[model samples]
Target: MLMAKTAIITGSSCIGRESAIALSKAGWNVVLTARRADALKETSLLCESLENCLVLPGDVTDEEFVKRLFNETVVKFGRVDLLFNNAGVNAPAIPLEELSLEAFQNVISVNLVGPFLCAREAVKIFKNQTPVGGRIINNGSLSAHTPRPMSTPYTASKHAITGLSKCLNLDGRAFDITCTQIDIGNAATSLTARMEKGVLQPDGRRMPESTFDVTHVGSAVVHIASLPPDVVVPQFTIMTAKAPFAGRG
Candidate 1:
C-alpha cells in the first residue's frame, strides 16, 4: 500500500491551524508544531482525521528542537513530503529608532532563523529519502515587497525570507527540492485584527484596511502543495482586493 503523503506545519494558530486542517481534509498526514502545547493540541483536534494529525509542540528557533521535530515526524509518519515553514513573530509597531534591540532580534529569531533551521532539516530528509526530493513553502508577507510604517523588524525579516526562498530554489534544483514563498497581505486572523480598527499608514495616517478570509490562504497552500514535483511556483501573492498593497506607500 502506498503511504499517505505527510506535511509538517509550524505555527499552531491562525494560518498554520487552518492549513493543517485543510491538508488533513485532503488526506495528508500532518505534524503540527509551535511553542504552546495546548494550542497545538487545539489545532490537532480540529483536523479532519485526528488519527493522522500529530501535535509536536516546541520552539522552532532552537536548532536541536527543529532537528527533533523532523526526526519525530519521520519516525511517526514514515516520511515528510512537505514542510510549511510558517512560524513567525512581529515586534511592537513602534518607530525603528525606538524599537529595542531585543525586540528586533526576537523577530529575526522566530521569523527568519526558525524557518532556516526547519528547511535545513527538511532538505536533509528530502535529499536522503527514497524520493530524493520534497517541497518547502515559506509564509512571507506583503511587507516583503513594500513596508508599512513602524514595521521595521517584521518587514526586514520578511524581505530576508524572499532571498532565502530564492536561494533554496537555486540550490535545491540538484535534488528536486522546490521552495515557494507565499506573500500574504491583510489576511483576517488574530494577528490582523488590528487592521479592523486602524493601522498606521505610510503618510502617518491611521486607516482601516480591508482583509480577506484566512481560509483562502489555507486553500492556496493546499493547491500549491498538491502540485506535481516538477511544477513549481516560486512566489505567490494573495491579498484582499481592496487592500492597499497595490500602492502601499
Candidate 2:
C-alpha cells in the first residue's frame, strides 16, 4: 500500500487554514498547529476528512510545543513530506523609539524563533527518513522587501525570514530537501482587514489598500508543495495587482 503524503501547517490562521484545506483536498494528511484550539478545530472541519486532520493547538513560540508537534505528527503519520511554516505575528504599529521591547520580542519569538525551531525539527526528520527528503514552504511577506510606516518589528523579522529561506535552500540541497518561500502582500485576511479602511502609508498618508482573497495564497502554496523533488523554486512573490507596493512613496 502507498503511504499518504503528510504536511504540517503552523499558525492555522487565514492563509494557513486555507492552505491546510487545499492540501488536504489534494490528498495530503495534514497536521494543523496554532495557539487557538477553536480555530484549529474550525480548520480541521474544512479538511477532506477528519481522520486526515490532526489539530494540535499550542503557541509556536514554545520550544517544547514545537518539539511535541513534530513528534506527534511522526507518531501518527509515518513521515512528514511538507512543512508550511506559516505561523507569524506582527508588532503594534509605532515608531521604532516607541515600540516596546516586549512587543518586539514577542514578534521575533513567534515570527523568527518559532520557524527556526520548526525548521530544525523538520530538517532532522528529512535527513533521517528512508527516502531522505522533504519540502519546506515558508510564508513570507512583502514586508521582507519593503518597509511601511511604523512597522519596524514585522519588517525586520520578515527580512530575517528571507535569509533563513536562502540558508535552508542552500543547506538542504545535498539532502534533496527543498526550501521555498512565497512573499505575500495584502491578502484578504483579518491581518489585513484594516487595509480596506485605510492604513498608514510610507509617505505619512492614510490610504486604503487593495487585497486579494486568501485562497490565492492557498493555491500558490499547493502549487509549490506539488512540485517534483528534482525541481526547486527558490522564492515567489504573490500580491494583488493593484496593491500599493511596487512604487510606494
Candidate 3:
C-alpha cells in the first residue's frame, strides 16, 4: 500500500479550515496549525479521516513554534509533501498616517514573517528528506495586485508574498521543490462579514462587494495540491465573478 501524502496547513479558520477538510476528504494526511487551539481542534474534527489529521496550535510568527510544527509533522507523518503557507493577518483599514505602527508591525509579522519562517523550515526538510523535494502553496490576496483604499499594511504584506513565492520557485528548481501562490478575492468568511454591509472602495465610496463561497477556495487548494510533480502553477487567482475587481477603483 502507498503511504498517504502529508500536508501542513497554517491558519485554522475559514480558508485554512476549509482547505483542511477538503484535503482530508481527498485522502491527504493534514496537519493544522494556528494560534487558537480550540479552532484548530474544531477544524480537525471536521476532517474526513480524523486519525490522519493532527492539530498543532501556536503562533506562526514565533520561530521556535514554527520549528516545532515541522518537527512534529515529521514525527507523526514520516515526511511532509506540502506546506500551505496560509496564516495571515490584516491591520485595520485606515489611512497610512492614521495606521498605528504597532498594527502595521503586527500585520507584517504574521502575514510576511510567519510565512518566511515556515517556508525556511519546509525547504530544509524538503532538501534533506529522501524524496528531495516538496511544494509550498502561498495564500496571497488580490490586494497584491491592486491596493484598496486604506489597506497599506495588508497590501504591502501580500505584495511581499508574491516576491517570496517567486524566489522560492526559482531557488527550489534544483531540489524539484515548487512554490505557487493563490490570490483570493472576497470570500464569504467571518473576516469578510463586514463586506455584506459595505467596504471602502478606491473611489471614496463604501460599496457592498460580492463574495463567493469559501468552499471554492478549499477545492482550489486541493486541486493545486493534487497536481503532478512535473507540473507547476506559478500563480492562480480565484475570485467572485461579480466582484468589483476588474474595474476596481
Question: Which runs in model 1 stand beyond 4 Å of their true positions?
Answer: none
TM-score of each: 0.98, 0.97, 0.98
Clashes per prediction? 0, 0, 1
Query: What TM-score, to 2 decimals, does candidate 3 have?
Result: 0.98
In the range 143-237, model 2's lDDT, one tens digit per residue, is 88988888888989999999999999899999999999889988899888888899887677899989998898888888999998889998999
Which parts of model 3 have CA positions greater than 4 angstroms off? Answer: none
Look at candidate 1 and give me any clashing residue pairs.
none
